[model samples]
Target: MTSTDKYIEMKVPAFILTGLLCGLLLQPVAAQTGPAHNRPNIILIMSDDMGYSDLGCYGSEISTPNLDSLAMTGLRYTRFHNMGHCCPSRAALMTGLYPHQTGLGWMTGTNFHLPGFTDELNEHCVTIAEVLKTAGYATLMAGKWHLSHNIHAGGPQHDWPLQRGFEKFYGILTGAGNYYDPASLCRDNTLITPLNDPEYHPQHFYFTNAITDNAVRFMQERPKDKPFFMYVAYTTAHWPMQAPEEAIEKYKGKYDAGWDVLRRQRFEREKALGVIDKDATLSPSDTHPWAEEKDKAAMARRMETYAAMITIMDQGIGKIVDELKKEGIFDNTVIVFLQDNGGNAEGTGFGGPEGETRPVVPKNAAALKPLGKDEVQYAINPPVTRDGKRVMQGKNVMAGPADTYLAYLKPWGNLSNTPFRKYKNFVYEGGVATPLIIHWPDGIKAERGAVRTQSGHEIDLMPTIAQLAGAKYPSVYKGNEITPVSGISLIPTFEDKPLPPERAIYWSHQANRAMLMGKWKIVSGGILNGPYGKWKTYVSLPWQLYDMENDRSEMRDLSAEHPDIVKKMAAMWDKWAHSTNVYPMPWKEVKPPLRPDYMSTPWEYPDF
Candidate 1:
């Protein structure tokens, strides 16, 4: 029987009464007896809502000298992939299994009483931190912790970072929040305002800097005798583009050239850098002609602010690396950098009257002038903050300020993913592809700056780390049997080698689905159904195929020419989806409105 013949073996629930029976009987894992130097310190750094070509080495015009330097000294994987959305990507990176198998199939904002969409890290899966801890590595995390839905100040604590695996935690508990005064921000299980936090006090409170500073602090203050694993998840350039004015000044008129020129420039740079194939033609631009746009200046400013946020993040990476060098642990530390997903298409600052013009702040904002220092942030979209100022949002509102919130918008997001076709939430190469930079000075045998083209996924991170740390991936941890790692370690590729040619890489987000096997890929996606409370469905399109070897950008659809391949890959995806709790995808259990023409095939092969 082929992979398409049946669902994957039932992973977590193979044992009966897993949760109830394994109560207080769980014993703590014993420490590792291996030499500390043999097991290197692991630093896994991840960015939120970033694009495939957003790094300087990956083709973007953004200034990311620190990360670019990492690529120069380490290894860059050109064909690396991630889950097409935020939470699921984090879930995949944390657990070696795919998102659904880890019980976080969707965002942590909603729970539909479905096994896969629990909005929490279930007991069935163990995180990398948990596994590494068993090997005597100190686990520290600083940045967005979006695995749990219970973000209230006094809600369930079972799924929070401290409870899951990390010993020290900082950053927001939920997804997407104002950078200046993020909601659900925590400090080692305690919720505290940025200004009110007792341990940290910066001249100003910028979330990216805070996450970075705390990460360095955690590493500096970690037990010197014990090797550590630090996870830095930056929400920079995600939404509400807010960066220091000085950083924003660096890219004032950079993007004035517009997305068209920017796309071509990035495409050329990517080819020149060998990040993409030399013969690979640029994907057709999805953005409109920049000439006709009414507010070109404002459009350009959005990108400038976006670039500044990333540059600030790059500066933070430099700080962390500096600390590693200062402590004499730089050579022995394994640093892996990647993104959660591709560039976001959400239109945050895109709705109102166009042509860019910031009106005066609302009168009510001036009326209630209360200092928000003592207040714990509870609102995801903070209405007012940092002295009770209204958080403004408009196409006219420029992006770099504490009281303003705006996305760089969809057109610029398209540029961020230059040479790729779609945005976040779709399983197209654009949505899933990301730059994966791995640097291990003492361990990696790969040539400095070597680029590996073998496909790797976020799910591979945990396994890779486990292999390097010499950690035993648990059979049963804290009384619950853990799921087998779904991904293989890329350690072999670290020596400038190759991954198995026939291996399959999978992706499923919202109602989009895709599978890459060998040089062929099969994918399908759906449009957003208006607003909230609706189901995401794939009833609008049919399965499409591409020969990734020739068209990694997914420029041509080979579904019609190779129906047999599509059938074969689709069947394999079906089996994997069913076994991983990806089947009965939200839309299947509910009766969502269906598009007429393609409705026939959807029910037979419900996606996502």
Candidate 2:
């Protein structure tokens, strides 16, 4: 039956009631009718590789007055998590399901267990944009779209942002790139002119600033009457450790105390602020003592660079927020700020083929030796001696010719994680944990700076947005039944209610598999392939269990004493892995797996 006919049939009883009320009150039925739609505008701001405590509101010494103000006026989630890495997290956020459900069970590339991630987001899954757009919302997106690298192959590809439901698109298509010279920057499928020339577009060239500018333009041109959904993805706080000179200068010498003191300070502040369990213990240092000692100076500089990146990104975000307020939409717009992943532990300093197209080390060392060649400029501060002598020593200077080698040294990266254990890419708290701030002036009433103890994952993004916009999720996309939406709405938490019960959340990238069933987490990543592959699990690898209620930092592992709990959790994890087809693949050691033939499958009608 037609939609109009269905609506007419359902409205017969309501019409009869309305007629009776009209007859009694001598009023027109239209006079008492409600407005057609009242969906609020949504602005989703995402930062790349931002640590849990990088924002001023998150207890960073770095001055982020705007973001601090945002945190104060919004709802801060203490235990929110991304999917441990970028592409996968974004995929989960976009699809409202686990990363594996989106086919990006891992990173993009051939070496990982999941190779050729083009199938990561199939036509089956409806994006948050597609759902909103279908409901008449104007969709705009800015920043990273790392779902597929094929966009960089230089052709008229139909699988880009515009194709994926965004009415407008800007920013890089890859994971990481030079902030100053964005390699895969695109302006709606067209390659943006690179900022390679020193004289061209000088100040407006940084990828973060450019993205903000484009986003602002997109917003300004949008119709005020139409509800809008914008995904502002900033590539700041990622690597290449480059930022505006002013921002870098602002943080210079801020980390002289090094990682040890900084981490402790952050932990104490978080505890006092009630961002984490007051009695929660801090995780032990995961980096080797000697390595930490060797890179102190470089580490400090690296952090300085990273802080600068975050500061600038925050500044850009502030501009966007200011624009919204100026346009009188701030109060109604649902603003959500989160990170694609946790702060990275990827080796930024000692450069190699760490995946950058250009060799991280300068080609001619003798020519650029004064500028620091093989050495990644940023160093992690190591342990101090009993006498209080500084350890992890290295020269502090910018690494790149235009930017810096610019990596955020180790000590600061460790501290960026604050109370958490490892850094980005790992399944540890350090990798998955991310600071999430939700600001909706109309719907959220917790307080100016309310703290919430809700557990949020990337998958929850789609469902929450869908609920907010009052759009029904499409069960079938491109004719096949898509995986059901696995995330629940977070609206209850916004009302200051206790966080709802969470059954489980799972993650896997490469051979790394992590599962969280309530407070118990089972994470194991070792060199083995397939479900039945020989496994040399880490005995000392620490099978951790947190009360979570009491130990938000995950410092104390009650696993040894709780053997039965550990066994149960592990068994549950194994069952999930097998059911989800998460067997490891030694893609790095063998030839590429044969691509699935979509033509062999039955085709579905295209409605999405």
lDDT of 2 by residue, 1-608 (tens): 43322332342332133224222322212221113245678899888887787777877787777777888998888878888888888888887866666667665442233422334466667789988898788999999887764655456465678888999888777777666555566777675554332222545467788888888889998876789999998888776777767776777788777777777788888877777776777877655553356546555666777777777787888899989989887887888988887777666444444323233333443333321122211111112211222222113444322433345545556778878777677776788888888988877777788998777677777877877776667767658787667665676678777533434666665555666655556665433344332332312133456556666656666877767666666665566565554654333333223446664434322110
Give the clashing residue pairs of candidate 1, or none. none
Candidate 2 positional error at 456, Å: 2.0
CA RMSD per model (angstroms): 5.6, 13.1
Which one is best on TM-score?
A: 1
Badly placed stretches (over 4 Å) of model 1 are: 1-34, 353-371, 528-530, 536-540, 589-608
lDDT of each: 0.81, 0.66
Tens digits of per-residue lDDT for model 1, 1-608: 33422212223221122222222112221232146555789999999999989999898889999999999999999999999888999999999778998888988877777878777988889999999998888999999988988987777899998898899999989887888888888998888988889999999889999999999999878888889999999998798888888888889899988999988999999999999999987877676799988788777888899999999999999999999999888998999999988898887655455534332234555434544677688666665666756777777677788778788877888888878888888899779998999998877776789999888888878777887787777879999988777777777687667765566778888777888877888988754454653655435358899888899888889989878778767777777788788865676433445557844544443332
The alpha-carbon deviation from the true structure for residue 52 of candidate 2, after best TM-score superposition, in angstroms, is 1.2
Error of 2 at 163 (Å): 1.1
In candidate 1 the C-alpha lDDT for residue 182 amounts to 88
Q: Which candidate tops lDDT?
A: 1
Report model 2's TM-score to 2 decimal places.
0.79
